[model samples]
Target: MVSPLTVVKSEGPKLVPFFKATCVYFVLWLPSSNPTWFSALIKCLPIFCLCLFLLAHGLGFLQTHPSATRIFVGLIFSAVGDAFLIWQDQGYFVHGLLMFAVTHMFYASAFGMKPLDLRKGLVIAVLSGSSYALLYPCLSGAFTYLVGVYVAIISFMGWRALAGLQLIGAAWRWTKLAAGSGALLFILSDMTIALNKFCFPVPHSRAIIMSTYYAAQMLITLSAVESREPVEAYGLSKTN
Candidate 1:
C-alpha cells in the first residue's frame, strides 16, 4: 500500500508539464509586443519567473535522484540559452549555442548510461556523428570554432552514454528507457533549433524550438523521478 506522502509527492511531477507549458506561453506572448528598452526589462519578468520556477522545481527533484542531475543541468543551460536568445544581442548567440550544446551532451550521457550492451555505443556514435556531419555543412565561419568544440562534446557524450550502458542494473532498465527517451527528445529539440537558425530560418522557429525544449526538460525530470522512486522504494521494502 502507498503512503499519503507518496501520493502527494507524485502530484509534484505531474505539475511539471503545466508549469513548463505556462512558460512557453509567456515566452511567445511577450516578444510580439516589441517593447521599448525599458519596457523590455519589465516584460522579462514573466519569462524570468518561469525559468526560476523550472530551475527550483528541477533542482528539488534532482536532490533525491542523482541520476537525473545531468537532465536538470541541461534545463539550466537551456534557460540560459533562452535568455540569450531573448536579449537579441548578436554577441550572445555563441553563448547560447554553447549552453545548448552542453544541454545535448548531458542528455547523450544520460541516454548512454542505460542498461544496454556497450556495443550500442557504436549506434549512438553513428547517430550523433550523422547529425553533426549534416548540420556542420550549413554552419558558417562565424561559428566554426564554436561548432567544432560543440561537435567534440557531442561525440564524447555519445561515447559516455554507450560506456554507461554496461553499468545499468537489470531492474533499472525501464527507468533508464524512460529517462533516455526524454534525453532523446531534448536532442531532437536542440537539433531542430540549430537547423532553424543555420539552415532554414523558419517563421515560427522560436515557438517550435521552445515548445520541444521545455517539453523535453520536464519529461526528463519526471522520468528521473519515476525511475528512481520505484527502485528506491522497492529496495527499501525488500530489505525491510
Candidate 2:
C-alpha cells in the first residue's frame, strides 16, 4: 500500500516548479506594491502556473472520476478571479468576486454529491452567518448585497467540503483531509480579502491572502489527483 506522502511525492516533478514560481512571484510582487504593466504581467504568472498545476493533477484523475473535471473547472475560474482581482482599478473587482462565487459553486457541487455530516454543516452555517452579520454593516452601497451573495456561496462550499470528509473511504482519508482543510483555508483567505477591502486594512494583507489562496489551491489539486481509485480498466496498475 502506498502512503499518502508517497502519492504526493510522485507528483513532485510537476508541482515543484510551479511552487518555486509562486514563491518567486510573491517575493518580487508583493513588496513592490505598485501596479504597472510589467508588475501586472509578472503577477499573473504565479496564478497561471498554479492553475496549470491544478489542471495537470485534475486531468490525471479525470479518466477515473467525472467529478475531477469539476475540480479543474473550478480552478480555471479561480485563475480568472485572480486575474480580475489583480487589476482592481480596471473595473474588475466585481467581476473577480463573481468569478470566485461561481468557482465556489463548482467546488460545492463536487463535494455535495456525497453524504453530508450534519454537525459540520451546522458549524459552517453558524460561522458563516455570524461573519456575514458582522461584515454587512461594514460594507456600504451596492457592495453589501454583492458581497453577501458571495459569502453565502462560499459558506455552502466550505460546508460541503466538511461533509465530504465524512464520506471518504480509508484509502482516501488523507485526500479528504487535505481537501477539507483547503476549503477552510480558502474561506479564511476570502474573509481576509473582505475585511481588507471593506472593514479595515490588514497589515501585509496581500501576502497573507495570496499565500493562503495558493496553498489552498495546491492542496485541493492534490486531493483531486490522489483520491481516485487505480484505473485497472485503463491498464494502469495500482503502483502506477
Candidate 3:
C-alpha cells in the first residue's frame, strides 16, 4: 500500500483549483452588487473545489481518516449555504442559516465526541452564552429560537473540535492546531455576520466574513489531509 506522505505529496499540487476558486470569489463575485446566477456559482466555487480535492484521494481516504467523508458532506452544505446567502434579499436568509447549521453538525460529527472534555465545553458555553446575550435584543420572530439553535449547534461543534484533536507530535500538532483554529475562525466569521446583520454595521464585514470563512474551511480541509498519516491520533479505532 502507498504511504500517507506519498499521497499528500502527490495531492499537494492539486490545491491549485482551491486557490483559483477562492481568488475568483474574492475578486469577481464579492465586489459585485448584483446577485446573478453567475455570481452565485462563483460564490460556491471554493467549496466545490475543496470537495474535489478531497475526492481526489478516492474512497480509500475514508479508511485513512474516519472523518474524511463527513468533512466532504460538510463542505457541500457550506457551498449550498454560500449560494443561498447570496439571495438573502429574496428571503433566503433562513435557508442559508439552516444550511450552515447542518454544515456545523456534520463538522461536529467529523470531530467525534470522546473524553467529554468539560473544560472545553465550559469555555464554549461561555462564549456562546455571551454571544447570545449580545444578540438577544436583536433577535425576534422565528429567528429568536432559530438563531439560538444555530448558536448552540456551532458552539457544540467548537467544543467537539477543541476536545477531539490531540497534539502528540509535530505533524499531529499542526493538524490539531489547524482544526482548532478553523473552528474558532468559523465562529468568528459567523459572529461578524451576526453583528453586521442583527446589530450595528461592522466595518469591512463583507470581506472579513468571507475571508475568515474561506480560511476556516481551508484549514479544516487541510487538517483532514494531515491526519491521514496518523489516524491513531484521531481515536478512530475506538469508534470504528
Highest-lDDT candidate: 3
Highest TM-score, which number? Answer: 3
| Descending-TM-score candidate ranking | 3, 2, 1
225 Cα displacement, candidate 2 (Å): 0.9
Please write out the lDDT profile of model 2 over residues 1-240, one tens digit for every residue.
457678767877788867787877777765334556666556556656756766675555565654566677888788778777777767789999999999888877766546667887888889999999989889898898998899889988888777767444563476777688899899999999999988999998888988888888877766776544345744655672
What's the distance in Å from true for residue 118, model 1? Answer: 3.3
Off by over 4 Å in 3: 1-11, 30-32, 166-172, 226-240
Model 2 segments more than 4 A misplaced: 30-33, 36-38, 54-60, 166-172, 227-240
Q: What Cα-based lDDT does every candidate model obtain?
A: 0.57, 0.76, 0.84
Best-first order by lDDT: 3, 2, 1
Candidate 3 accuracy as TM-score: 0.86
Clashes of each: 1, 0, 0
> Which candidate do you rate higher for lDDT, 1 or 3?
3
lDDT score of model 3? 0.84
